[model samples]
Target chain A: MNVTTVFINALAAVCLVFALIKDTTKTKQALKIAIISFFRIFPTVLAIIIIIGLLSGFVPESQISKIVGENAGFRGVLTVAFLGAILHIPSLISFPLAASLLEKGASITSVAVFITTLTMIGMVTLPLEIRILGKKLALLRNGLSFIIAIIIGLIIGVIL
Target chain B: MKKMSKEKQKKGLVKDMLFLGIILAIAIILLLIFPEKKELVISSSKGFFMEMILILPAVMILMGLFAVFVPNDVIVKYLGRSSGIKGIFLAILMGAFPTGPLYVAFPIAAALLKKGARISNIIAFLSAWACIKIPQELVELQFLGLKFMITRLLLTILFVIVMGIVIEQIVLLSEKTTKHEQTS
Candidate 1:
């Protein structure tokens, strides 16, 4: 196993021991809470992962590269940032995707903007956000995220 | 306390049984769908193990501890509307300090909102911090060049600040409209 794996395993073992020695009641409570929380969030996580996987499968990396290449210029950066906002992908997936896009000739600016916006902005999660928080708050958050994403793209474009 | 303890124990037992049953069901379904061959084993390891490592149980335990210690009132009062730019800046700072996974952030954010933390600022804090942590940036700088890392970092901070301000305005406007409509 890798260092990360070994570290994580050791951490888990420590926690497990702590749980065992702690109050039996608190241990049970913690387990219940963890299980409930995991199941509640699993469906949403699963759906997003599947959708991203499908996009990776269907969309030719070459096309993504062409549209976001150096020659694509200002429009390319904007397009990438906008796409990233819409996708609202998590970083775990976005990092590898960015790496692959770079390999396929995508501009650094485009990749940077896309990654920034993907995490910072959220189109797909907007509706759910509105429901959980109020519409006013949701709209404000998303609107600002969109605008800032563009700014980030431009700055990255200019600098790197 | 004794009665509560017995009830809790009973509840715990039931919940544990349910959790085990669900896991078993999922395992059986997966087994049926993808036969347990060497290739299947390899694929499962590649996917599940990677995810598990990232979502380590220790991280979850830390998150649980965080939830119990950090009061919602503190987040809302300091990071709430009355604090203004200072609050937003603090929020951004907090975000920059890497914590656990995104899931942990959700509960903390929700609690802050319930306690009156402004939504726009919370969003700004979460998005910015989650996206561009200082620790992560340090790693990126090593691999992706210092210039590239700094540029991305500065740009992300700028975007986060602007987004926070704009979102605040939108919320204020929406609140005004609702009040106007109610009067009408």
Candidate 2:
């Protein structure tokens, strides 16, 4: 396993042991929750895996770069920002895909925007958000997230 | 309410599985048609799968531990009791942990709202939960390098806070105007 994987697993193991020692019942509850989440998240994770395969296979890195590269400008940044908001992949998985995109020549702005919007605004989860948080707060949070995503992208593009 | 959510969760799960199946079918078809792309697709997918397999369990465990140990009520109680600058920071700090997903945060945000937490802190908390996750940052640092990860992290934090305040102000203003109109 890679360093990140090792570190994460070690951390989880440590936490689990400590939790078990502190409270067996709570630790069992944690395990149950983990298993449930793993099942619930499995399908999406697999879908993302396949999508990543298609993305890298069908579209050449050069083409991806053309769309989101340094030359793609503000429009490119906006495109990725919107794409991120619409797509519902877990943010952790997005990191490697984003890193590959960067290596392929996608601009800092587009990458940053994609990550920001992908994490912040969830178009797929909007109904749930509205149901729980009310229409006003839900709409405002998402709407403003989209705007701030672009702004954050632009600033990162400049600084980095 | 719990039953309704469980039903909804099942529906969502089925939909996701269907989507995965369709994507898998398309991928297989594409590979069959374009034999040249087979190796590229297989190798790339395998690489990502390996990467994900290693860390995903750990991430899930962290999420579970937080979900069980911390509990939503605790979050609402703490966030609700605090306000101003301290509350904002606390929200952000609390949010930075592995607290499941943004969708999960919605209900907590609603609870905070009911508990009379400031709109700005709720917004901040949500934003932080969405992007500033600790496990996510570790993954980002692994893939994107220290410089890229740190820069984006700082930038996102700054902007999210600003966005939180801005959204809160605008929302409050609109609410005031609407209330005035009603009174008039």
Candidate 3:
């Protein structure tokens, strides 16, 4: 295993051990919590991953590259920003996808917008977020995130 | 209070279903519009299924475990206002620790906010760590040039800090307005 994986495993082990040592009841509670969290989040993650994979397969890299190329300009920036807002691919998938897009002649601006929006804006997770945080807070957070993503993309476009 | 909680829960369930339906419709449309070239379908299906199998279990278990183990008090203590720079520092630290996807982070972040984490800090914690994980950065730096990686990292940190402060102010103003409305 890589150093990162080893370190993560060690950390998880340490936490588990610490919880166990502290109290048997707490340990049981933690396990239950973990199980519940897993069930709640698993289906959504699975569905998202499948959709992203399908998207990558279906969309031609050439077409994606053309629309988001450096020359695509302001329109490209807006497209990247909006696409980022709408698509909720995990970072794990996004980095590779961005790299592929870059290879296909996509501009750094588009990639930057994609990365920024990949985390900040989330169309797929909007309902879940609204349920948890309420509509006002959810809308505010997402709205601000979308706006900031465009700004970041523009800055990156100019500087990098 | 009980009645209010029940009403909210009922509303939330409906919203969740609506959202799921929308996503499914979109997915179906995409699939139809881009019917896979037969040659590529096999490879794509294999990749898609493999990723689903691997990620689903891992993400679920991690989210559940994190939700249970990391208490509100601990999150608040580290990300809370009174914690100051130390809190921000700790928030960064926690963000560095590997977790599930961004969606999982949302529920936890919301929970932290309810428990008194500043909105700005939560935004910072989510955005910075969510996008530029340290471990991921290590791998990316090797391929993407360290200069690019470092520049991105530094800028993202700055962005998170500024955004956090802005969000906190917005939240505070909203809270005050709500309080005024309640009293009036």
Candidate 4:
């Protein structure tokens, strides 16, 4: 494995050992939670992998760069931002796919915007958010997130 | 409530599985049609899958540890009492902790609201929870590079603070207008 992978796994091992030392019961509970989440997220993870594969394999790199490349302009950024908002993939799993996009000719700005919007605003969960947090807070948070995501992406594009 | 949530969770899983099935079917069909692209598709996916498999368990373990140790009530109790600049930071810090999905934070945010937390801090907390989490950052760093990750992180923090201020004002303004209409 690579450094990041080794580092992450090592960190987890240390934490797991610490947890076990502190309390076996709680550690077990943690493992249980971990397993549940692993299984729970597995399907979506596979789907994302396959989707990324198809994206790289089927779609031409020229088209990707053409649409979301450095020259795609504000329209490209907006499209990616909107797509990020709508898509329900987990943020953790989105990174590699994003990297693939970046390597395939997508602009850093578009990718950054895509990640920000994907995490910040969730169209699929809007109803649930509204139900729990009220219409005012929910709508305000989401509406503001969309605007800020683009702004953040644009600023990042300029800086980096 | 627990039963309802459990049922909802099951439905969500089923939906995910169904979605996966559809994608798998489509992928298989496409692969069959274009045999030449199979190697590219599989290799790329396999590389990514390996990366995910290696790190995901660790991430999940960290999440689990946080869930057990940190607990939601602690966040609610502390964030509820916090105010001012300190409160804002605390909210962001606590919100940045791994706590399952964004949906899980909604109830905590609502609880803080009920306890009279500042809207701006609440916004900060929610935004941080949404985009800035420790595990998520690690993944981003691994794939997107440190420069890109750090740059986006800093920008997100800055803009989120701005968004908190603007949204707080708008929310308060609308509240005032509603109260005025009701009284009138």
Q: Identify the candidate with maximal lDDT.
A: 4
Error of 2 at A23 (Å): 1.1
lDDT of 4: 0.90
What C-alpha lDDT do the candidate models reach, one value each?
A: 0.59, 0.85, 0.63, 0.90
Task: Report lDDT (Cα) of residue B76, candidate 1.
Answer: 50
True contacts kept of 1: 0.19
Tens-digit lDDT track of model 2 for A78-155: 899889999988787798788767866899889989999999999999988988887878898999899988988888
Give the 10-residue window scoring lowest on summed lDDT in candidate 2 chain A. A96-105
Better of 1 and 2 by TM-score: 2
Q: What value of lDDT does candidate 2 attain over all alpha carbons?
A: 0.85
lDDT of 4 by residue, A17-106 (tens): 999999999999999999998899999999989998999899999999999999999999999999999998889888989999998999
Best by DockQ: 4
**DockQ of candidate 4 compared with the true complex:** 0.68
Off by over 4 Å in 3: A1-64, B1-73, B178-184
In order of DockQ, best first, we have 4, 2, 3, 1
lDDT per residue (tens digit) for residues B109-134 in model 3: 77677767766667777775576565
Residue A56, candidate 3: Cα error in Å is 11
Evaluate candidate 1 and give its CAPRI docking class based on DockQ.
incorrect
Better of 2 and 3 by TM-score: 2
Is model 3 an incorrect, acceptable, medium or high docking prediction?
acceptable
